[model samples]
Target: MVTTNKEKDLYKKLSIQVSLNGLSFCILNRKDNKICYFKKVDFEKQLDPIKVLSKIELLYEQEEQLNQPVDEVALLFNNALFSLVPENLFDEDNAASYLKFNTRILKTDFIAFDKIGQDTVNVYIPYANITNYFFDRYGEFEYRHSLSVLIESFLSLPKETDTPKVYLHVHKNYYELVIIENGKLVFANSFEYDTKEDFLYYLLFTAEQSKLDPEKFELILLGKINKNSEEYKMAWEYIKNISFMGPFHPFTFEETAKPKEELSEYLLIKSL
Candidate 1:
């Protein structure tokens, strides 16, 4: 089949989301605003950076969709080593200082920040080796903290009420809690858990600390979670209102790449 330039341009934007627990990638046809490809790999257990890189290398060698040439690439790193700073007080020179209080950092570790709107900056650590690998392959690409994408996308949603709403983005072993009120970010934090009780504790604690009543406020779940999941069952026992987040972006998907759950790849699909 002869490939036209228009066809070549269709799948030019690639967005990847990586973490210790898993990795997901999405290929976007910008001209038509459609997702041409999407795939996700979940590790049995959290792997170290080196092992993660190896997995990524193996994936590139095996996944034909990833081999396509692209005009733009975006990498979103998901990890606990991140902090949000008010834009006015953020200093680029002291990026490490902002994270040191909450996250342990090595002297040799590289730091990066994503400017979220005009009011906040997300400071975190990106895997240097993995980034270098992408650099070698794509020449140049954009990368950001996964929280930045989540925050930005959630903030873009239309406000339904003035009451504070809790958004829980669940992962394999961790979850991000974001509370927004009247379309503004009220609080955001990531919590790690090993049991359903731990998950409930964090959710309730966050609500209490934020002075949001679990019975009154709406709780929207995203990522790898559903009503049937243990986490959801546990949350439902205490939290009176709970629901899953739906797709807010306009991008459509090819049948082969369409996600079974529209909310499953929330961060990766929105990263583009």
Candidate 2:
């Protein structure tokens, strides 16, 4: 099949996000302001370093064979030492190393302790935040960051108008509920809890701190969590302000290149 230059370009560039347990990758046509394809992969069980890269390479080759032209890649991951394998390991002679082909990794779950400049915080992310700790900190942090990026990207879409849009992200690990008023993050915060009572307390505490009336603003939940979980039910029993985000899935991207199922999915969410 004779693929056009435009079509080939569509397959070469990818926006990828690699999480502690999964990968999410997407193809974007920046010139056209369009997303050509996307996919998600889960990699929680495999621990071998070589197996991981082999899987990633398989995905790339699959895409290429399908006539996908991907020359650029964007990767996202947690800020942890264990996940930091040397960039050279994934290389094959003169070929591309997964890290080298895409070195732009945005370390999520990081908080700046010292102010570096205007609006820039010198942040520090707990290693535990992105690792297999006593608690599910890494998963929680990954989900939180993924949800944030997803919401931000949606809001920043080219055609979005200049208006306020409220959002809520519910992860198994955390909840990110916020409002973006006129392209500005008017209010936002993350809460943690295991019990219903604790969750309610955090939400109420956050509402008060943001100074936004729950009755007036819109609320959304992002991840795979029950809005009707007993805790969620009890909290909203009297409060009629909050709303569930979607019975909808994120916009899916179709592509020619395929990665190891796990890495592909992880990168897909990151890039989203």
Write down the worst ten-residue block by lDDT for model 2.
134-143
For all predicted structures, in order, the TM-scores are: 0.93, 0.48
* TM-score of candidate 1 versus the correct structure, residues matched by position: 0.93
lDDT of 1 by residue, 1-272 (tens): 12223234445688899999889998999888899999989999899999999999999999998998887888989999999999999999989999989888988799999988779899999999999999888776788899998998889888878878899998887899998888878899999999999999999998998888878999999988997899999899898988888657899899998988878888888877
Give candidate 2 regions above 4 Å deviation. Answer: 1-8, 27-69, 78-151, 154-166, 181-183, 226-232, 246-272
Residue 179 of model 1 has an lDDT of 87
Native-referenced Cα lDDT, model 2: 0.45
Q: 233 in model 1: Cα distance from truth in Å?
A: 1.7
What stretches of model 1 exceed 4 Å from their correct place? 1-11
